[model samples]
Target: QIAQESEPGLAVYALAAQADMYRWRGDHAQARAVLSKARQLAEEKGLDFEQRGLLPVAEGITLAESGEVKAGLRLLSDGVRFLEQRRAKRELARARFLLAKAHLLAGDKPQAVGELRRALDLAEEIGTHQFAVVEGQHAVGLLKLGIAQGVAPCRALAEKVQQLGGLGAAEVRTGEGAEEGAASRLEIYALGEGRVVRDGHTVSSSEWRTAIVKELFFYILLHGPLERDAIGVVFWPDVSAKKMADSFHTTLYRMRRALGGDVVVVEGGQYRLGDVDYWFDVEEFEALVERARLLPPHAWQAEDLWRRAVALYRGDFLPEVQRVWCVPKREALREMYLEALVGMGRCHEARREFEGAVGWYRRALEVDELREDIHRRIMHCHAQAGRRSEALAQYHRCREILKRELDIEPSVETKGLYERMAGKGPD
Candidate 1:
């Protein structure tokens, strides 16, 4: 009620929680009614919450109980898929547990067991046991299974359920277990466009408190576990040490609040982000390129690795940021991207795939437009493809771009290639 009166944008969460409680009590009508309000409020107010997925899940379970089993099951399945895509592990585990109950009630013991096992595994992996409702639901399912499938296999499950019954009164704790549960699985892309995708949702700049906060995020990621002093020196170089400390602490607090406290941990006079599993596009690009480089040119996997690396280089690292610190790293990644592209082109050239070779070389030219070497390669590919006019056109395009942009002509090798393509011979 307070949420509805004071902060209505958050009211949908309370409604969803009430609906889950109703569902736990087996009051299908009340569950559905609460979910209806939640869905309506969520739609009307544009409220985004992690618990929003619970509405569909609870509704599906209610429908399954009221004898609309197939429709209910379908909704349940869809809800699970949706939550999984959202990376809502807690919600997904609950949904799976509910689906298991539905399966057991419908007399599909094997399917019920399968769903229960999946729910348990996911819950354990996420390190959360807050769902006593889910545990009760699971226990009930296992009891049914034990009756039908004999006592031996479900003995341990029965024991687990007994343990879960006492955990309802447990306080929601925050340290390692909770941190693991709440830590967003991030996929950061800093290679080209900077994107911080947390749990499959791309965090918009609007979500940040300030540009500095966002930069701090990338800064910590780029240079991990820096001391408070070192960080101050880099970002607040002009400020006094005491002033820098105050500003740094304030910024750090905001970062922790915005990105999760566990995500930015301070310890032993230094700060580092939590050990969350993350995939950085730049790291992946480098790994793929390194692997590709290690393989022989004719190796089947080499071309695929090189292409994957090229695809990952979306642009220069954090192109919008003009910090002095970002310059050398950005240039290094650009060079790595170019190397992968050129390597792929050469690999295709060696395989007698002239058109494929030209495609990659052209891609390289798109990044480094002044690369007369790639321009020469494109001309060679066009000539080999029997399009002499296009070959000649590519040479002229290269020559014009160089002259217009740099007030310089193509190199000797480029000129030689142009002459050969012009049928004036290599001399």
Candidate 2:
């Protein structure tokens, strides 16, 4: 309409709008084309800010949605800088929201949550509903925060999303979602080099069959080596002991065949993963957490290491494996995983990555809200970052939770942290 009416300014707006529509429809190519045209038109009209800010923002969204996430993030960051210089808060919010979405898609939950919170604040300030966008971002952010902070809000957000009938609805109810979608034809990962096979042809697939063997492989990869007896007891608990052993052997045989002979080896009657250069998400997660823990105290790389680790923990290990025996191990590993996440958030806090640290801490609390140490850490992170009111509020929340759930008082450590924040001696 703008083009037909010869309204060049409106034409730019129209192009941007069209790009967004295409992006929402998942037609990233069309979005990119529209954004490119908008960029050329903005330059032709000598609209410096629009050329630098609007064009790159649109381009970044298109690129990220199209799976070129790193490139898209770079472009969006540049665009955000330009918008910031112009004091364009609304545009900046939109850019940040888009960047957050890109990060979430790339499995960088901490970064995504930070950006989402920033966008939320901006959106609220502008009085824009942005409910759809904000809600989705908040849902994912809350879930990640829950994993790090041991808080209930993350799960609550997830539940809210399901109540509203969202993509994660099933996940909220069952605590399991569909595995990550198959990689697109052009998809590639930097960590591992291999072609995904589909129908006996390498067409760039990502569908790993979620059989019992595959789940066991993932479990071993995450928790590291398990005895054959323990594995059978956990996964095949309903079957008789003799039958379970046979099942284990059969499963292992099939897994070896599917994953290739060299992927797993039995040693001393315990199954262990073999020498494989390929990256499994769970293995990457453990390595990242270990690296973060090994980092010197107050090191800047600690947060980065933790971020990488948390990103790989997409969900609970073998979420569908729901036998009673499996629950203990799964929950135990989840608790340990949450602790590692809390450690990462503390690292981020030491580096003054306040929002990032908050994200991590929140995720930990989501996993286990009863951990007093995490509550204290969150309070300290908030206070040290100059969010004193939020810090105090966190203390109050801890007090309330302790009172309501455990019928106990805050620990000396937690009280001490809060007292210091209040400029008083520990109670």
Candidate 3:
């Protein structure tokens, strides 16, 4: 900004630097706005290639964040080579940081971690630990992915993240990064029956001080940070305001006691579950499904990703919760689970393993038997496997379910498929 007045040419570099700062802070719209100014200025001034290279790396990181992983990778990879040619370790550190974001977005956890390690080393070598600290979310997120992938967390990196403050900051500052061990790490299994486990021990019913306390734990975990008044309404709107206050505080205290004092973080008049390096099953389950979406739909990696996702699903999300707010969440998650199952089935069908394909499609139907598409797929599988009688049986069953449950006849597609198959008889 200062260079814009005294030296407009240098403003291009200033804008690139500003764009990166915005990207690190997750203000991508602002970052792009900055990048646009930089590009315009560079073009108007007829800047050299070296002067414009910084813009691509910054733009590539934003592009990656916007889900254009392939295009982003091309630019960022070019950025990496550009920095390497110059042997600009500091700029290369920034490129690694940028590339790490792209790689993580591309679902390449190992490569993301490798980029992060180099970024950290380069930052340290260049005495930019403060810069690393400012981009703490990137550090913490990649570190968690590494841990999930069986890579150990580096204490040195964790310290820089602590300086930037967030959930893991407390643990690192307390010098309990590793020494606290996995035993203290809570795993909230909200996907199915909603259980909490720690240290290989399932927290018993007695562990929760009261029923509301357990309910509120899920509320915080799922809904994220919420205001006290808003939460009071959700959990105890029926009671008098004074009574609601008493009950809310009581439940909050019990929650803290049962789940550790630092587990609940209060900030900006909102409460959020924090301070611990805990795993929420819902997050991992959703992440796997999303990562699968990033890959080619029919790729083996996508298939395997769905398999892992569905395995963690266990059942519908928080089935016991009857809150109105949870209903849509449960329905949405069930849809994702169904998608994974159907994806697996299609993968099998693509391989001409009709038997296995039918099995997976059947599982999907079991989750929600009203799925006409799954029913049709099963029929296709049967016909593919030359099991005409079973194919006919599936059609009859689909007809009955649609009739009884939805009070509707089979669609034209279903009817047409059955007609064609019946006319052919056995293959």
Best by lDDT: 3
> lDDT for model 3, on a 0 to 1 scale?
0.73
Error of 1 at 126 (Å): 37
Error of 2 at 88 (Å): 88
Q: What are the TM-scores, per candidate, against the unseen true structure?
A: 0.55, 0.43, 0.56
lDDT of 3 by residue, 180-229 (tens): 12236787898878888765678777768567678898898778799878
CA-lDDT, candidates in order: 0.71, 0.64, 0.73
Candidate 2, residue 289: how far the Cα is off, in Å = 1.6
Model 1 residue 39 lDDT?
Answer: 79
Instruction: Note the clash tally of each candidate.
Output: 0, 18, 0
| Candidate 1 per-residue lDDT over residues 285-316, each given as its tens digit | 88998899898777889989998987788778
Candidate closer to the true structure by TM-score (higher is better), 2 or 3: 3
Task: Please list all clashing residue pairs in model 1, or write none if there are none.
Answer: none
The TM-score that candidate 3 achieves is: 0.56
- Distance from true position, residue 211, model 3, in Å? 1.7
Instruction: Please provide, for model 2 over 181-207, each residue's C-alpha lDDT reduced to its tens digit, 9 standing for 90 to 100.
Output: 212122211122222232244432222
Lowest lDDT sum, 10 consecutive residues, model 3, at 174-183
